[model samples]
Target: MKDMVTPTMPVFEDMLAAHDRIAPHIHRTPVLTSAYLNGLSGAELFFKCENFQKAGAFKVRGACNAVFGLDNETARRGVATHSSGNHALSLSYAAGRRGIPCHVVMPRTAPQAKKDAVRGYGGLITECEPSTSSREAVFAEVQAATGAEFVHPYDDPRVIAGQGTCSRELIEQTGGLDAVIAPIGGGGMVSGCCLTLSRLGPGTLIFAAEPEQADDACRSLRAGRIIADDAPETVADGLKVPLKDNTWHFVSRHVTDILTASEQEIVEAMRLAWQRMKIVIEPSSAVALAAILKNPEIFRGKRVGVIVTGGNVDLDRLPWSAG
Candidate 1:
Protein backbone atom coordinates (compact mmCIF):
# COMPACT_ATOMS: atom_id res chain seq x y z
CA MET A 1 0.00 0.00 0.00
CA LYS A 2 1.26 3.49 -0.81
CA ASP A 3 1.62 5.45 2.41
CA MET A 4 -0.59 8.46 2.81
CA VAL A 5 1.36 11.68 2.98
CA THR A 6 0.92 13.72 6.13
CA PRO A 7 -0.20 17.26 5.33
CA THR A 8 1.52 20.10 7.09
CA MET A 9 -0.64 22.56 9.02
CA PRO A 10 -1.50 25.57 6.85
CA VAL A 11 -0.65 29.06 7.96
CA PHE A 12 -2.46 32.28 7.10
CA GLU A 13 0.18 33.07 4.51
CA ASP A 14 -0.53 29.78 2.78
CA MET A 15 -4.19 30.79 2.51
CA LEU A 16 -3.16 34.06 0.85
CA ALA A 17 -1.06 32.14 -1.63
CA ALA A 18 -3.87 29.69 -2.33
CA HIS A 19 -6.30 32.52 -2.95
CA ASP A 20 -4.03 34.00 -5.57
CA ARG A 21 -3.29 30.62 -7.13
CA ILE A 22 -6.92 29.61 -7.55
CA ALA A 23 -8.41 33.03 -8.32
CA PRO A 24 -8.91 32.34 -12.01
CA HIS A 25 -10.47 28.90 -11.51
CA ILE A 26 -13.07 29.83 -8.86
CA HIS A 27 -15.86 32.28 -8.25
CA ARG A 28 -15.85 34.99 -5.66
CA THR A 29 -19.22 33.67 -4.41
CA PRO A 30 -21.61 36.37 -3.31
CA VAL A 31 -22.85 37.17 0.18
CA LEU A 32 -26.62 37.38 0.56
CA THR A 33 -29.02 38.34 3.36
CA SER A 34 -32.62 37.59 4.20
CA ALA A 35 -34.65 39.83 6.50
CA TYR A 36 -37.10 37.10 7.45
CA LEU A 37 -34.35 34.76 8.56
CA ASN A 38 -32.76 37.57 10.52
CA GLY A 39 -36.06 38.32 12.29
CA LEU A 40 -36.57 34.64 13.09
CA SER A 41 -33.08 33.97 14.42
CA GLY A 42 -32.40 37.49 15.80
CA ALA A 43 -29.05 37.48 14.04
CA GLU A 44 -28.00 39.50 11.04
CA LEU A 45 -26.88 36.63 8.84
CA PHE A 46 -24.72 37.02 5.76
CA PHE A 47 -24.91 33.85 3.73
CA LYS A 48 -21.75 33.13 1.73
CA CYS A 49 -23.44 31.49 -1.21
CA GLU A 50 -20.88 28.91 -2.23
CA ASN A 51 -23.77 27.02 -3.76
CA PHE A 52 -23.26 29.34 -6.71
CA GLN A 53 -19.64 28.34 -6.96
CA LYS A 54 -18.16 26.63 -9.98
CA ALA A 55 -18.84 22.89 -9.98
CA GLY A 56 -21.82 23.76 -7.72
CA ALA A 57 -19.95 23.57 -4.41
CA PHE A 58 -17.24 25.18 -2.25
CA LYS A 59 -15.00 22.11 -2.35
CA VAL A 60 -13.70 23.32 -5.70
CA ARG A 61 -11.59 25.91 -3.92
CA GLY A 62 -9.53 23.23 -2.22
CA ALA A 63 -9.46 20.95 -5.23
CA CYS A 64 -8.24 23.75 -7.45
CA ASN A 65 -5.47 24.65 -5.05
CA ALA A 66 -4.27 21.04 -4.89
CA VAL A 67 -4.46 20.47 -8.63
CA PHE A 68 -2.97 23.77 -9.72
CA GLY A 69 -0.19 23.65 -7.18
CA LEU A 70 1.11 20.38 -8.51
CA ASP A 71 4.29 20.38 -10.63
CA ASN A 72 4.17 19.24 -14.26
CA GLU A 73 5.48 15.71 -13.66
CA THR A 74 3.09 15.13 -10.75
CA ALA A 75 0.21 16.75 -12.62
CA ARG A 76 0.79 14.42 -15.57
CA ARG A 77 0.05 11.43 -13.35
CA GLY A 78 -3.37 12.97 -12.49
CA VAL A 79 -5.16 13.16 -9.07
CA ALA A 80 -7.39 10.93 -6.93
CA THR A 81 -9.40 10.96 -3.67
CA HIS A 82 -12.40 9.59 -1.79
CA SER A 83 -15.40 11.78 -1.07
CA SER A 84 -19.09 11.39 -0.37
CA GLY A 85 -19.96 14.01 -3.01
CA ASN A 86 -18.82 17.61 -3.26
CA HIS A 87 -15.09 17.00 -3.09
CA ALA A 88 -15.26 14.24 -5.66
CA LEU A 89 -16.96 16.46 -8.20
CA SER A 90 -14.84 19.46 -7.22
CA LEU A 91 -11.64 17.52 -7.80
CA SER A 92 -12.91 16.33 -11.13
CA TYR A 93 -13.74 19.89 -12.13
CA ALA A 94 -10.28 21.10 -11.18
CA ALA A 95 -8.55 18.18 -12.87
CA GLY A 96 -10.59 18.69 -15.99
CA ARG A 97 -9.54 22.32 -16.13
CA ARG A 98 -5.93 21.20 -15.90
CA GLY A 99 -6.53 18.58 -18.59
CA ILE A 100 -5.59 15.71 -16.27
CA PRO A 101 -7.36 12.51 -15.41
CA CYS A 102 -9.19 12.49 -12.05
CA HIS A 103 -10.08 9.29 -10.25
CA VAL A 104 -12.49 9.19 -7.30
CA VAL A 105 -13.73 6.54 -4.88
CA MET A 106 -17.18 7.46 -3.68
CA PRO A 107 -19.67 5.69 -1.45
CA ARG A 108 -22.28 3.81 -3.45
CA THR A 109 -24.94 5.59 -1.44
CA ALA A 110 -23.82 9.11 -2.37
CA PRO A 111 -26.43 11.35 -3.96
CA GLN A 112 -26.85 10.47 -7.62
CA ALA A 113 -26.76 14.13 -8.56
CA LYS A 114 -23.21 14.34 -7.24
CA LYS A 115 -22.14 11.12 -8.96
CA ASP A 116 -23.53 12.42 -12.24
CA ALA A 117 -21.71 15.71 -11.75
CA VAL A 118 -18.46 13.87 -11.17
CA ARG A 119 -18.84 12.03 -14.44
CA GLY A 120 -19.97 15.19 -16.17
CA TYR A 121 -16.65 16.73 -15.20
CA GLY A 122 -14.77 13.74 -16.63
CA GLY A 123 -13.93 11.86 -13.43
CA LEU A 124 -13.64 8.09 -13.33
CA ILE A 125 -15.55 6.62 -10.41
CA THR A 126 -14.87 3.63 -8.18
CA GLU A 127 -17.68 2.83 -5.79
CA CYS A 128 -17.17 1.70 -2.20
CA GLU A 129 -19.43 0.83 0.71
CA PRO A 130 -20.69 3.72 2.79
CA SER A 131 -17.98 3.50 5.42
CA THR A 132 -14.60 5.12 6.00
CA SER A 133 -12.80 1.76 6.05
CA SER A 134 -14.18 0.68 2.71
CA ARG A 135 -13.47 4.07 1.20
CA GLU A 136 -9.85 3.91 2.26
CA ALA A 137 -9.43 0.34 1.03
CA VAL A 138 -10.95 1.03 -2.37
CA PHE A 139 -9.09 4.33 -2.75
CA ALA A 140 -5.81 2.52 -2.12
CA GLU A 141 -6.45 0.20 -5.02
CA VAL A 142 -7.48 3.04 -7.35
CA GLN A 143 -4.45 5.09 -6.38
CA ALA A 144 -2.13 2.13 -7.05
CA ALA A 145 -3.64 1.37 -10.41
CA THR A 146 -3.77 4.97 -11.64
CA GLY A 147 -0.61 6.26 -9.90
CA ALA A 148 -2.52 9.49 -9.21
CA GLU A 149 -1.43 11.97 -6.61
CA PHE A 150 -3.92 11.62 -3.78
CA VAL A 151 -5.63 14.86 -2.87
CA HIS A 152 -7.53 13.88 0.24
CA PRO A 153 -10.97 15.49 0.48
CA TYR A 154 -10.37 17.61 3.58
CA ASP A 155 -7.33 16.28 5.36
CA ASP A 156 -4.81 18.12 3.26
CA PRO A 157 -3.05 21.43 3.82
CA ARG A 158 -3.48 22.52 0.22
CA VAL A 159 -7.18 21.75 0.48
CA ILE A 160 -7.55 23.51 3.83
CA ALA A 161 -5.79 26.60 2.54
CA GLY A 162 -8.08 26.57 -0.45
CA GLN A 163 -11.18 26.27 1.70
CA GLY A 164 -9.93 29.16 3.85
CA THR A 165 -10.34 31.49 0.89
CA CYS A 166 -14.12 31.41 1.38
CA SER A 167 -13.85 32.99 4.80
CA ARG A 168 -11.26 35.44 3.62
CA GLU A 169 -13.76 36.60 1.04
CA LEU A 170 -16.47 36.60 3.70
CA ILE A 171 -14.51 38.90 5.98
CA GLU A 172 -13.64 41.24 3.13
CA GLN A 173 -17.24 41.35 1.94
CA THR A 174 -18.82 41.76 5.39
CA GLY A 175 -16.34 44.39 6.67
CA GLY A 176 -16.18 42.09 9.70
CA LEU A 177 -18.30 39.63 11.62
CA ASP A 178 -18.88 38.65 15.22
CA ALA A 179 -19.02 34.97 14.34
CA VAL A 180 -18.78 32.58 11.37
CA ILE A 181 -20.61 29.28 11.14
CA ALA A 182 -20.19 26.47 8.59
CA PRO A 183 -21.08 22.78 8.33
CA ILE A 184 -18.34 20.51 9.59
CA GLY A 185 -17.88 17.09 7.97
CA GLY A 186 -14.20 16.28 7.91
CA GLY A 187 -13.58 19.76 9.38
CA GLY A 188 -12.03 21.03 6.12
CA MET A 189 -14.24 24.08 5.71
CA VAL A 190 -14.42 24.78 9.45
CA SER A 191 -10.68 24.39 9.77
CA GLY A 192 -10.21 26.76 6.87
CA CYS A 193 -12.51 29.24 8.57
CA CYS A 194 -10.46 28.81 11.73
CA LEU A 195 -7.21 29.30 9.83
CA THR A 196 -8.42 32.52 8.21
CA LEU A 197 -10.46 34.03 11.08
CA SER A 198 -7.80 33.45 13.71
CA ARG A 199 -5.44 35.73 11.82
CA LEU A 200 -7.65 38.03 9.71
CA GLY A 201 -10.60 38.30 12.07
CA PRO A 202 -9.18 37.25 15.40
CA GLY A 203 -12.21 38.42 17.33
CA THR A 204 -14.56 36.37 15.19
CA LEU A 205 -15.95 33.29 16.90
CA ILE A 206 -15.85 30.15 14.72
CA PHE A 207 -18.61 27.58 15.01
CA ALA A 208 -19.11 24.22 13.28
CA ALA A 209 -22.57 22.81 12.57
CA GLU A 210 -23.33 19.12 12.12
CA PRO A 211 -26.20 16.70 11.76
CA GLU A 212 -27.27 15.14 15.08
CA GLN A 213 -27.05 11.67 13.57
CA ALA A 214 -23.48 12.25 12.40
CA ASP A 215 -22.16 14.36 15.25
CA ASP A 216 -18.71 12.96 15.82
CA ALA A 217 -17.18 16.41 15.41
CA CYS A 218 -19.46 17.79 18.11
CA ARG A 219 -18.64 14.85 20.36
CA SER A 220 -14.95 15.13 19.60
CA LEU A 221 -14.93 18.80 20.60
CA ARG A 222 -16.43 17.87 23.95
CA ALA A 223 -14.07 14.95 24.53
CA GLY A 224 -11.01 17.05 23.59
CA ARG A 225 -9.94 14.25 21.24
CA ILE A 226 -10.83 12.83 17.88
CA ILE A 227 -13.94 10.62 17.88
CA ALA A 228 -14.60 8.95 14.56
CA ASP A 229 -17.72 7.09 13.34
CA ASP A 230 -17.08 4.89 10.35
CA ALA A 231 -20.54 4.57 8.81
CA PRO A 232 -22.78 7.16 10.43
CA GLU A 233 -25.95 7.91 8.45
CA THR A 234 -27.53 11.35 8.09
CA VAL A 235 -29.58 13.46 5.69
CA ALA A 236 -26.49 15.66 5.29
CA ASP A 237 -24.78 12.98 3.21
CA GLY A 238 -21.80 15.24 2.50
CA LEU A 239 -20.98 15.48 6.20
CA LYS A 240 -20.77 11.79 7.07
CA VAL A 241 -16.97 11.67 7.05
CA PRO A 242 -14.88 11.98 10.23
CA LEU A 243 -12.36 14.68 11.07
CA LYS A 244 -8.69 13.97 10.54
CA ASP A 245 -5.62 15.33 12.39
CA ASN A 246 -4.94 18.05 9.80
CA THR A 247 -8.37 19.61 10.25
CA TRP A 248 -8.51 18.76 13.97
CA HIS A 249 -5.47 21.01 14.45
CA PHE A 250 -7.43 24.14 13.55
CA VAL A 251 -10.83 22.92 14.81
CA SER A 252 -9.50 22.03 18.26
CA ARG A 253 -7.58 25.26 18.68
CA HIS A 254 -9.79 27.95 17.16
CA VAL A 255 -13.38 26.72 17.08
CA THR A 256 -15.57 28.33 19.75
CA ASP A 257 -18.13 25.50 19.66
CA ILE A 258 -19.61 22.69 17.59
CA LEU A 259 -23.39 22.69 17.27
CA THR A 260 -25.79 20.01 16.03
CA ALA A 261 -29.39 19.77 14.76
CA SER A 262 -31.80 16.89 14.21
CA GLU A 263 -32.47 15.36 10.80
CA GLN A 264 -35.91 16.97 10.76
CA GLU A 265 -34.42 20.32 11.66
CA ILE A 266 -31.94 20.11 8.79
CA VAL A 267 -34.70 19.21 6.32
CA GLU A 268 -36.85 22.06 7.52
CA ALA A 269 -34.01 24.50 7.26
CA MET A 270 -33.19 23.29 3.73
CA ARG A 271 -36.79 23.81 2.73
CA LEU A 272 -36.94 27.18 4.48
CA ALA A 273 -33.90 28.46 2.59
CA TRP A 274 -35.54 27.54 -0.67
CA GLN A 275 -38.86 29.09 0.39
CA ARG A 276 -37.61 32.30 1.99
CA MET A 277 -34.20 32.95 0.55
CA LYS A 278 -35.10 31.40 -2.81
CA ILE A 279 -31.72 29.74 -2.85
CA VAL A 280 -31.06 26.05 -3.52
CA ILE A 281 -28.90 24.58 -0.74
CA GLU A 282 -28.26 20.98 0.17
CA PRO A 283 -28.83 19.33 3.56
CA SER A 284 -25.16 19.74 4.45
CA SER A 285 -25.35 23.46 3.78
CA ALA A 286 -28.54 23.75 5.82
CA VAL A 287 -26.88 22.30 8.92
CA ALA A 288 -25.40 25.71 9.85
CA LEU A 289 -28.75 27.48 9.61
CA ALA A 290 -30.46 24.73 11.61
CA ALA A 291 -27.84 25.04 14.36
CA ILE A 292 -28.36 28.80 14.52
CA LEU A 293 -32.15 28.44 14.79
CA LYS A 294 -31.85 25.71 17.44
CA ASN A 295 -29.49 27.84 19.52
CA PRO A 296 -30.53 31.40 18.91
CA GLU A 297 -28.91 32.74 22.06
CA ILE A 298 -25.42 32.19 20.69
CA PHE A 299 -26.12 34.15 17.54
CA ARG A 300 -28.84 36.65 18.50
CA GLY A 301 -28.21 40.31 17.73
CA LYS A 302 -24.80 39.45 16.32
CA ARG A 303 -23.52 39.81 12.80
CA VAL A 304 -23.01 36.19 11.78
CA GLY A 305 -21.59 34.83 8.55
CA VAL A 306 -23.16 31.55 7.44
CA ILE A 307 -21.35 29.48 4.84
CA VAL A 308 -23.96 27.98 2.50
CA THR A 309 -21.67 25.22 1.41
CA GLY A 310 -23.31 23.67 -1.69
CA GLY A 311 -26.39 23.24 -3.91
CA ASN A 312 -25.83 19.76 -5.29
CA VAL A 313 -28.98 18.01 -4.14
CA ASP A 314 -30.78 15.16 -5.90
CA LEU A 315 -33.91 16.97 -7.06
CA ASP A 316 -35.87 13.75 -7.59
CA ARG A 317 -35.22 12.77 -3.97
CA LEU A 318 -35.50 15.99 -2.04
CA PRO A 319 -35.21 15.20 1.66
CA TRP A 320 -38.43 17.01 2.56
CA SER A 321 -40.44 15.21 -0.15
CA ALA A 322 -39.31 11.78 0.99
CA GLY A 323 -42.06 9.39 2.03
Candidate 2:
Protein backbone atom coordinates (compact mmCIF):
# COMPACT_ATOMS: atom_id res chain seq x y z
CA MET A 1 0.00 0.00 0.00
CA LYS A 2 1.15 3.53 -0.79
CA ASP A 3 1.45 6.24 1.85
CA MET A 4 -1.66 8.40 2.07
CA VAL A 5 -2.02 12.03 3.08
CA THR A 6 -5.02 13.24 5.02
CA PRO A 7 -6.91 15.75 2.95
CA THR A 8 -8.71 18.71 4.51
CA MET A 9 -12.26 17.60 5.30
CA PRO A 10 -15.51 19.54 5.37
CA VAL A 11 -16.57 20.95 8.72
CA PHE A 12 -20.03 21.08 10.29
CA GLU A 13 -20.40 24.68 9.12
CA ASP A 14 -19.76 23.60 5.54
CA MET A 15 -22.58 21.10 5.84
CA LEU A 16 -24.81 23.87 7.24
CA ALA A 17 -23.95 26.09 4.27
CA ALA A 18 -24.57 23.21 1.86
CA HIS A 19 -27.96 22.47 3.42
CA ASP A 20 -28.95 26.09 2.89
CA ARG A 21 -27.52 26.39 -0.61
CA ILE A 22 -29.25 23.34 -1.98
CA ALA A 23 -32.37 23.52 0.17
CA PRO A 24 -34.63 24.90 -2.52
CA HIS A 25 -33.40 22.41 -5.12
CA ILE A 26 -33.10 19.04 -3.38
CA HIS A 27 -35.65 17.21 -1.26
CA ARG A 28 -35.21 16.74 2.46
CA THR A 29 -35.90 13.04 2.02
CA PRO A 30 -37.83 11.36 4.82
CA VAL A 31 -36.50 9.20 7.62
CA LEU A 32 -38.51 5.98 7.62
CA THR A 33 -38.74 3.07 10.09
CA SER A 34 -39.90 -0.50 9.71
CA ALA A 35 -41.21 -2.72 12.50
CA TYR A 36 -40.16 -5.95 10.79
CA LEU A 37 -36.65 -4.75 9.96
CA ASN A 38 -36.15 -3.40 13.45
CA GLY A 39 -37.41 -6.62 14.97
CA LEU A 40 -35.25 -8.77 12.72
CA SER A 41 -32.11 -6.81 13.49
CA GLY A 42 -32.96 -6.35 17.13
CA ALA A 43 -32.33 -2.63 16.78
CA GLU A 44 -34.31 0.52 16.17
CA LEU A 45 -33.54 1.21 12.51
CA PHE A 46 -34.05 4.59 10.91
CA PHE A 47 -33.66 4.64 7.16
CA LYS A 48 -32.83 7.95 5.52
CA CYS A 49 -34.57 7.39 2.19
CA GLU A 50 -32.41 9.25 -0.31
CA ASN A 51 -33.91 6.97 -2.96
CA PHE A 52 -36.84 9.41 -2.93
CA GLN A 53 -34.46 12.28 -3.63
CA LYS A 54 -34.28 13.92 -7.03
CA ALA A 55 -32.32 11.78 -9.52
CA GLY A 56 -33.23 8.80 -7.30
CA ALA A 57 -29.97 9.02 -5.36
CA PHE A 58 -28.14 11.05 -2.70
CA LYS A 59 -25.55 12.12 -5.31
CA VAL A 60 -27.84 14.97 -6.35
CA ARG A 61 -27.12 16.90 -3.16
CA GLY A 62 -23.42 17.07 -3.96
CA ALA A 63 -24.04 17.71 -7.62
CA CYS A 64 -26.39 20.59 -6.85
CA ASN A 65 -23.91 22.20 -4.47
CA ALA A 66 -21.03 21.90 -6.94
CA VAL A 67 -23.07 23.19 -9.88
CA PHE A 68 -24.74 26.02 -7.97
CA GLY A 69 -21.56 26.99 -6.11
CA LEU A 70 -19.93 28.03 -9.37
CA ASP A 71 -19.93 31.73 -10.30
CA ASN A 72 -21.33 32.97 -13.59
CA GLU A 73 -18.16 32.57 -15.62
CA THR A 74 -17.32 29.16 -14.25
CA ALA A 75 -20.90 28.05 -14.56
CA ARG A 76 -20.80 29.14 -18.19
CA ARG A 77 -17.80 26.90 -18.71
CA GLY A 78 -20.00 24.10 -17.29
CA VAL A 79 -19.10 21.14 -15.07
CA ALA A 80 -17.61 17.76 -15.88
CA THR A 81 -17.20 14.45 -14.03
CA HIS A 82 -16.52 10.74 -14.51
CA SER A 83 -19.07 8.42 -12.97
CA SER A 84 -20.34 4.92 -13.56
CA GLY A 85 -23.98 5.73 -12.79
CA ASN A 86 -25.80 7.92 -10.30
CA HIS A 87 -23.37 10.86 -10.17
CA ALA A 88 -23.52 11.22 -13.93
CA LEU A 89 -27.28 11.60 -13.84
CA SER A 90 -27.18 13.74 -10.70
CA LEU A 91 -24.63 16.16 -12.18
CA SER A 92 -26.63 16.35 -15.35
CA TYR A 93 -29.80 16.99 -13.35
CA ALA A 94 -28.14 19.79 -11.40
CA ALA A 95 -26.63 21.35 -14.52
CA GLY A 96 -29.94 21.14 -16.28
CA ARG A 97 -31.58 22.96 -13.39
CA ARG A 98 -28.92 25.67 -13.77
CA GLY A 99 -29.34 25.72 -17.59
CA ILE A 100 -25.63 25.00 -18.08
CA PRO A 101 -23.86 22.34 -20.07
CA CYS A 102 -22.71 19.21 -18.24
CA HIS A 103 -20.15 16.79 -19.66
CA VAL A 104 -19.97 13.28 -18.25
CA VAL A 105 -17.50 10.47 -18.81
CA MET A 106 -19.22 7.20 -18.01
CA PRO A 107 -18.22 3.59 -18.29
CA ARG A 108 -19.61 1.88 -21.36
CA THR A 109 -20.79 -1.00 -19.17
CA ALA A 110 -22.92 1.23 -16.97
CA PRO A 111 -26.61 0.48 -16.81
CA GLN A 112 -28.56 1.77 -19.81
CA ALA A 113 -31.25 3.26 -17.62
CA LYS A 114 -28.66 5.48 -15.93
CA LYS A 115 -27.19 6.50 -19.29
CA ASP A 116 -30.68 7.36 -20.47
CA ALA A 117 -31.26 9.42 -17.33
CA VAL A 118 -28.06 11.35 -17.94
CA ARG A 119 -29.12 12.12 -21.48
CA GLY A 120 -32.62 12.97 -20.34
CA TYR A 121 -31.03 15.60 -18.15
CA GLY A 122 -29.10 16.94 -21.16
CA GLY A 123 -25.66 15.72 -20.17
CA LEU A 124 -23.22 15.10 -22.99
CA ILE A 125 -22.00 11.56 -22.52
CA THR A 126 -18.58 10.30 -23.49
CA GLU A 127 -18.16 6.58 -23.20
CA CYS A 128 -15.01 5.11 -21.68
CA GLU A 129 -13.87 1.57 -20.99
CA PRO A 130 -14.92 0.26 -17.58
CA SER A 131 -11.64 1.05 -15.86
CA THR A 132 -10.33 3.94 -13.80
CA SER A 133 -7.52 4.85 -16.20
CA SER A 134 -9.78 4.92 -19.22
CA ARG A 135 -12.35 7.05 -17.47
CA GLU A 136 -9.74 9.54 -16.23
CA ALA A 137 -8.04 9.80 -19.61
CA VAL A 138 -11.28 10.39 -21.47
CA PHE A 139 -12.40 12.87 -18.85
CA ALA A 140 -9.17 14.83 -19.27
CA GLU A 141 -9.86 15.22 -22.96
CA VAL A 142 -13.44 16.26 -22.32
CA GLN A 143 -12.37 18.82 -19.70
CA ALA A 144 -9.65 20.18 -21.99
CA ALA A 145 -12.07 20.65 -24.87
CA THR A 146 -14.80 22.28 -22.78
CA GLY A 147 -12.75 24.07 -20.09
CA ALA A 148 -15.24 22.53 -17.67
CA GLU A 149 -14.71 22.56 -13.93
CA PHE A 150 -13.97 19.07 -12.66
CA VAL A 151 -16.48 18.13 -9.97
CA HIS A 152 -15.07 14.86 -8.72
CA PRO A 153 -17.64 12.28 -7.67
CA TYR A 154 -16.35 12.04 -4.10
CA ASP A 155 -13.05 13.86 -3.61
CA ASP A 156 -14.07 17.51 -3.97
CA PRO A 157 -14.73 19.65 -0.91
CA ARG A 158 -18.07 21.02 -2.07
CA VAL A 159 -19.30 17.52 -2.89
CA ILE A 160 -18.26 16.21 0.51
CA ALA A 161 -19.98 19.14 2.22
CA GLY A 162 -23.14 18.47 0.27
CA GLN A 163 -23.15 14.81 1.22
CA GLY A 164 -22.70 15.81 4.88
CA THR A 165 -26.10 17.47 4.84
CA CYS A 166 -27.82 14.06 4.78
CA SER A 167 -26.40 13.11 8.17
CA ARG A 168 -27.10 16.59 9.51
CA GLU A 169 -30.76 16.10 8.69
CA LEU A 170 -30.75 12.63 10.24
CA ILE A 171 -29.27 13.99 13.45
CA GLU A 172 -31.82 16.80 13.64
CA GLN A 173 -34.81 14.67 12.69
CA THR A 174 -34.01 11.76 14.98
CA GLY A 175 -32.97 13.97 17.95
CA GLY A 176 -30.17 11.48 18.57
CA LEU A 177 -28.93 8.10 17.38
CA ASP A 178 -26.76 5.44 18.95
CA ALA A 179 -24.96 4.79 15.67
CA VAL A 180 -25.19 5.70 11.96
CA ILE A 181 -24.36 3.26 9.16
CA ALA A 182 -24.12 3.97 5.44
CA PRO A 183 -22.92 2.01 2.41
CA ILE A 184 -19.44 3.05 1.27
CA GLY A 185 -18.64 3.18 -2.43
CA GLY A 186 -16.03 5.87 -2.78
CA GLY A 187 -16.74 6.68 0.87
CA GLY A 188 -18.53 9.92 -0.03
CA MET A 189 -21.68 9.41 2.05
CA VAL A 190 -19.81 7.61 4.80
CA SER A 191 -17.31 10.48 4.96
CA GLY A 192 -20.17 12.93 5.15
CA CYS A 193 -21.69 10.94 8.01
CA CYS A 194 -18.31 10.97 9.73
CA LEU A 195 -18.03 14.75 9.34
CA THR A 196 -21.44 15.52 10.81
CA LEU A 197 -21.70 12.83 13.50
CA SER A 198 -18.18 13.53 14.73
CA ARG A 199 -18.97 17.17 15.54
CA LEU A 200 -22.71 17.24 16.11
CA GLY A 201 -23.55 13.73 17.32
CA PRO A 202 -20.36 13.23 19.28
CA GLY A 203 -21.68 10.25 21.18
CA THR A 204 -22.93 8.49 18.05
CA LEU A 205 -20.75 5.81 16.52
CA ILE A 206 -20.24 5.86 12.75
CA PHE A 207 -19.98 2.60 10.83
CA ALA A 208 -19.37 2.01 7.10
CA ALA A 209 -21.00 -0.83 5.18
CA GLU A 210 -19.63 -2.42 2.00
CA PRO A 211 -20.01 -5.42 -0.31
CA GLU A 212 -17.56 -8.23 0.32
CA GLN A 213 -16.56 -8.17 -3.34
CA ALA A 214 -15.55 -4.50 -3.14
CA ASP A 215 -14.20 -4.32 0.38
CA ASP A 216 -11.34 -1.89 -0.08
CA ALA A 217 -12.71 0.57 2.48
CA CYS A 218 -12.95 -2.20 5.07
CA ARG A 219 -9.41 -3.31 4.28
CA SER A 220 -8.17 0.25 4.32
CA LEU A 221 -9.73 0.86 7.71
CA ARG A 222 -8.03 -2.21 9.16
CA ALA A 223 -4.70 -1.60 7.45
CA GLY A 224 -4.59 2.02 8.61
CA ARG A 225 -3.96 3.23 5.03
CA ILE A 226 -5.80 3.89 1.82
CA ILE A 227 -6.27 0.89 -0.47
CA ALA A 228 -7.34 1.23 -4.09
CA ASP A 229 -8.80 -1.89 -5.70
CA ASP A 230 -8.28 -2.18 -9.43
CA ALA A 231 -11.82 -2.71 -10.68
CA PRO A 232 -13.38 -5.16 -8.27
CA GLU A 233 -16.60 -6.82 -9.41
CA THR A 234 -19.82 -6.67 -7.42
CA VAL A 235 -23.58 -6.63 -8.03
CA ALA A 236 -23.56 -3.34 -6.14
CA ASP A 237 -22.14 -1.61 -9.19
CA GLY A 238 -22.21 1.89 -7.70
CA LEU A 239 -19.70 0.83 -5.01
CA LYS A 240 -16.84 -0.52 -7.16
CA VAL A 241 -14.59 2.49 -6.68
CA PRO A 242 -12.02 2.90 -3.93
CA LEU A 243 -11.79 5.69 -1.39
CA LYS A 244 -10.10 8.88 -2.57
CA ASP A 245 -7.89 11.10 -0.42
CA ASN A 246 -10.65 13.45 0.72
CA THR A 247 -12.95 10.58 1.68
CA TRP A 248 -10.15 8.52 3.22
CA HIS A 249 -9.37 11.43 5.52
CA PHE A 250 -12.75 11.30 7.23
CA VAL A 251 -13.09 7.48 7.08
CA SER A 252 -9.72 6.99 8.74
CA ARG A 253 -10.37 9.26 11.68
CA HIS A 254 -14.04 9.04 12.64
CA VAL A 255 -15.62 5.78 11.35
CA THR A 256 -15.78 3.28 14.21
CA ASP A 257 -15.52 0.16 11.99
CA ILE A 258 -16.17 -1.10 8.46
CA LEU A 259 -18.35 -4.15 7.75
CA THR A 260 -19.08 -6.09 4.56
CA ALA A 261 -21.77 -8.47 3.28
CA SER A 262 -21.77 -11.08 0.55
CA GLU A 263 -23.72 -10.88 -2.72
CA GLN A 264 -26.39 -13.28 -1.44
CA GLU A 265 -26.79 -11.21 1.69
CA ILE A 266 -27.11 -8.01 -0.36
CA VAL A 267 -29.81 -9.51 -2.58
CA GLU A 268 -31.75 -10.91 0.39
CA ALA A 269 -31.53 -7.58 2.17
CA MET A 270 -32.80 -5.75 -0.90
CA ARG A 271 -35.77 -8.09 -1.12
CA LEU A 272 -36.47 -7.60 2.56
CA ALA A 273 -36.44 -3.82 2.27
CA TRP A 274 -38.88 -3.83 -0.61
CA GLN A 275 -41.07 -6.53 0.91
CA ARG A 276 -41.24 -4.99 4.37
CA MET A 277 -40.51 -1.27 3.97
CA LYS A 278 -42.67 -0.94 0.81
CA ILE A 279 -39.92 1.00 -0.92
CA VAL A 280 -37.69 0.43 -3.93
CA ILE A 281 -33.96 0.68 -3.26
CA GLU A 282 -31.06 -0.33 -5.47
CA PRO A 283 -28.68 -3.09 -4.40
CA SER A 284 -26.03 -0.66 -3.17
CA SER A 285 -28.38 0.76 -0.56
CA ALA A 286 -29.09 -2.72 0.74
CA VAL A 287 -25.44 -3.19 1.69
CA ALA A 288 -26.03 -1.06 4.78
CA LEU A 289 -28.92 -3.25 5.86
CA ALA A 290 -27.07 -6.43 5.01
CA ALA A 291 -24.18 -5.33 7.20
CA ILE A 292 -26.48 -4.78 10.14
CA LEU A 293 -28.23 -8.11 9.64
CA LYS A 294 -24.96 -9.96 9.42
CA ASN A 295 -23.70 -8.33 12.62
CA PRO A 296 -26.57 -8.38 15.06
CA GLU A 297 -24.40 -7.97 18.16
CA ILE A 298 -22.92 -4.65 17.07
CA PHE A 299 -26.27 -2.92 16.69
CA ARG A 300 -28.28 -4.96 19.17
CA GLY A 301 -30.67 -2.83 21.22
CA LYS A 302 -29.29 0.39 19.65
CA ARG A 303 -30.94 3.08 17.60
CA VAL A 304 -29.16 2.95 14.26
CA GLY A 305 -29.59 5.19 11.25
CA VAL A 306 -29.00 3.70 7.78
CA ILE A 307 -28.53 5.84 4.71
CA VAL A 308 -30.27 4.35 1.64
CA THR A 309 -28.13 5.93 -1.04
CA GLY A 310 -30.10 5.24 -4.25
CA GLY A 311 -32.95 3.58 -6.17
CA ASN A 312 -31.72 3.63 -9.76
CA VAL A 313 -32.21 -0.02 -10.66
CA ASP A 314 -32.89 -1.31 -14.13
CA LEU A 315 -36.25 -2.98 -13.80
CA ASP A 316 -35.42 -5.51 -16.49
CA ARG A 317 -32.15 -6.55 -14.89
CA LEU A 318 -33.08 -6.93 -11.26
CA PRO A 319 -30.43 -8.71 -9.19
CA TRP A 320 -32.90 -11.02 -7.48
CA SER A 321 -34.18 -12.04 -10.91
CA ALA A 322 -31.04 -14.13 -11.18
CA GLY A 323 -33.24 -17.06 -10.19
Tens digits of per-residue lDDT for model 1, 110-213:
76766778899999999999876898889888887878999888889999999999999999999999999999999999999999999999999999999999
Q: Whole-model lDDT for model 1 versus the true structure?
A: 0.93
Q: Please, what are the lDDT tens digits per residue for candidate 2 over residues 1-323?
A: 01111145678898888889999889999999999998999999999999999999999998998889889998999998877588988999999999999998888897777778889989999999987678778988988899888888888778999999999999889999999999998989988888788888999999989999999999999999999898799999889989988898899999999999999999999999999999999999999999999999999999999999999888888888867
Local lDDT at 260 for model 1: 96
Residue pairs that clash (backbone atoms under 3 angstroms), model 1 = none
Task: Please report how far candidate 2 places residue 223 from its true position, in Å.
Answer: 0.6
Candidate 2 has which clashing residue pairs, if any?
none
